[model samples]
Target: MLVESLAVLTLALLVEAAIGYPGRVYTAIGHPVTWIGALIATLDRDLNRDDASPAVRRAMGVLALVAILAVPGALALALQAILSGFGLLGLLAAAILASSLLAQRSLHEHVAAVRDGLRAEGLAGGRRAVSMIVGRNPESLDEAGVSRAAIESLAENFSDGIVAPAFWMGLGGLPGGVLYKAANTADSMIGHRTPRHDAFGWAAARFDDMINLPASRLGAFLLIVAAALHPWASARAAWAAVRRDAGRHRSPNAGWPEAAMAGALGLRLAGPRTYGETIVNDAWMGDGRAAATAQDVDRALALYRTACALLIGLAALVAITALALSR
Candidate 1:
């Protein structure tokens, strides 16, 4: 299972390396959340009706992952035997799914649109882009705030959209990768600290944390490795920033990629960002390079490119290792 998983992931990654994203990726925009919601619904169905504590929510979250791995993985394997296109199709699907998780081109373009909008139209145009990509309050944001929002999204998504799914696909297969995305979507939707969600979404949040644990660190390391490739960002500085700042964020995860990205991009990231009406004072990540301007956001976009290429290399390595083991 492990060997097969690696080869398939490698093949998918090679497609990304060789050709890049196909044109139809935008079709699934924000739609993974629907599949993710369905998984949470299944867990909610079996959740202990007796005690709806945080513990129970967490148990349900685990059960959701178990549910994800069990069903889709079996179907994919079974389909592989009878279907000639199964392997390639599965590989393609895995690649597309993995590509969907990344925001290199999309993040860059979207943030650039915001910057352009700010220059061309006004704050209202900036708000539109900020509202679309970030979970923060868009109306109150100025140019600096808009840049900050975009930068934060770039850093955090480096973990969620890219690292987490790729790690799972490398560890498992297409179904494994897709399932991880679903788990992430569930956490994003249900996992909240609010009274309405703290009980109901508790399970999703914890599971999200668990799944992202290793991937976040890997993402940080990969950022350094990726920076080393171009010297656009400092590899040693990324390591130092991650070691110094990753633990400061509220999440056990998230901060690794953010810190690495900040160091790599040579910008300060994650301080105070508004979540809806809430103004949370997040501790700073990175080496506190506060000279960040709108252009810094643009450079972070380039860092994302490096991270994407680095991920493809990692996938190829995983594939090669798998093939060697199979022989």
Candidate 2:
């Protein structure tokens, strides 16, 4: 199982990098997170009642979160067990299933679309492209605003989408990745502080925080290492920014990579921004220029690519080491 797990980690990352989650596969079965989101939505609608007390809602949230986490792991483990008997075919199947949890290719594509849009159509296009990846209000963004938003989303999601799942998969195989994706999906869908969700989503939000703690740090480390390889990036600056600014972010986990990216690329990120009509007066992540442009986004993408390559290389090394030890 150790060898199999390592093989799945290597193959899944490569497969995802090569093709992403195919549109046809998504069209046929929908995405795994979406499927998990549906279940969370059902629980939210059914159990999260207005009449329920705060204690009741919080307890219900925990129940829902537990079920969400358990179901996916059980299914994946059962599938893995059944497939293991098939040898190589089982490994391939596990890899395919695991690949669905990663977003390395999709993340790059989405960020690249923002760069392309800004280059081709200016502010409107950039805003439109950035809107797809962020919850912030797009209409208020100038060109710099759009670029920063796109880059910020890229950095933050790079942690959640790539590092977190990969970290879990490396340690716990397919079921670990599945469990992580489920927790992440739950956190996204219900983990909010609005009047409707604050009490009910407490468990999901806190649990997500706990799970993401280690990977978030690792994500920053990877970005710093990647920055060292790129002429335009600064590993020293990335580490400095992480120390200075990661704590400034609202999320317990997101600021690490975002700050590292900001410092590495020498661009200020996560300043004041609008979400719908509300303006969040957030502290800036890096002390660099606040006036980002499409070119900055492109540069960020280049840095992201290098970081991703570094991550894959690290995973391959780990897989190779595990294989050697297993012998």
Candidate 3:
């Protein structure tokens, strides 16, 4: 069962990289994340009450997390069981469904758009493109700020949007992936330090951090290996930065990839940044250039692509080994 799950994960990664989630399909039925996000919104509206005590809200948040995971988890389990009975055809169907959980192609496109915006439309264009991917205030960003924001988003989402989901699916199959996505979606929606969400989102935020721990480290290793392969990137520096700086970022998981990418590409990332009117004074990653350019965005994309390729290779190797051992 574990071997089959790994195989399905490998296929899902390949399929997502090849075609992505098509716009037409999304327009017609919406994407899986959107579907999950809708449920999260409903839960937040229904369960999270403003007048409730923090302790009560925290407990409600835990309940909400379980409810959020159960619906998709059960559906994925049923689908996986039914498909397993169909053998190869069912495997293909499962892979296609699992592919929706990854964001390889979409992440590339969105980050590339920032570079394009910087090139064609200057700071305004860069800001516009970057605003789509990052939570930071776009208007506050200069050209370098926009570039850094895009690269940071790219690195962080590389872990969250790809590695983490793929890691879970490889371990526990379709239901695992669905459940991880559900928890991650909930975290993003409510896991802020705001007065309303501080207690209510506690469980989602903590669980997300715990589940992401392994994938975060694995993702950093992948980026370091990718840096070794690229003439322009530095594997040693990447490793050094991760060792020196990963734990400094606000998020325990986000720091690993961000540090690796920053070190590999020889750029400083994730210093002080604004989200709305709030400025987060965070530690910088990598002892390199702070004035990141559109060109640096391109460099980060190259490194990202190499890291993604490495992830695919790793998945294939695991699937093969798992199958052989099972046999």
* CA-lDDT, candidates in order: 0.71, 0.91, 0.94
lDDT of 1 by residue, 1-327 (tens): 677677666666555445545456535454444555665666666662545777766666567656654565566456544443676665565555555444455555676777666667776777787788888889777777787677778777777876787788778676667667767776776677765456666666788899999989987888788778765668787888898999999889889988887777766778887877899899888765655556777677777777777777777777787778778
Per-residue lDDT over 17-86 for candidate 3, one digit per residue giving the tens place of the 0 to 100 score: 9999999999999988899899889989999999999999999999999998998999999999999999
Which of 1 and 2 is the better model by lDDT?
2
**Weakest lDDT window of 10 consecutive positions for candidate 3:** 318-327
Pick by TM-score: which candidate is best? Answer: 3
TM-scores of all candidate predictions against the true structure: 0.82, 0.98, 0.99
In the predicted model 3, the residue pairs found to clash are none
**Candidate 2 ranges beyond 4 A from true positions:** none
List candidate 3 stretches off by more than 4 Å: none
Give the candidate number with the greatest lDDT.
3
lDDT of 1: 0.71
TM-score of 1: 0.82
Per-structure clash totals for the candidates: 1, 0, 0
Worst 10 residues of 2 by lDDT: 1-10
lDDT leaderboard ranking? 3, 2, 1
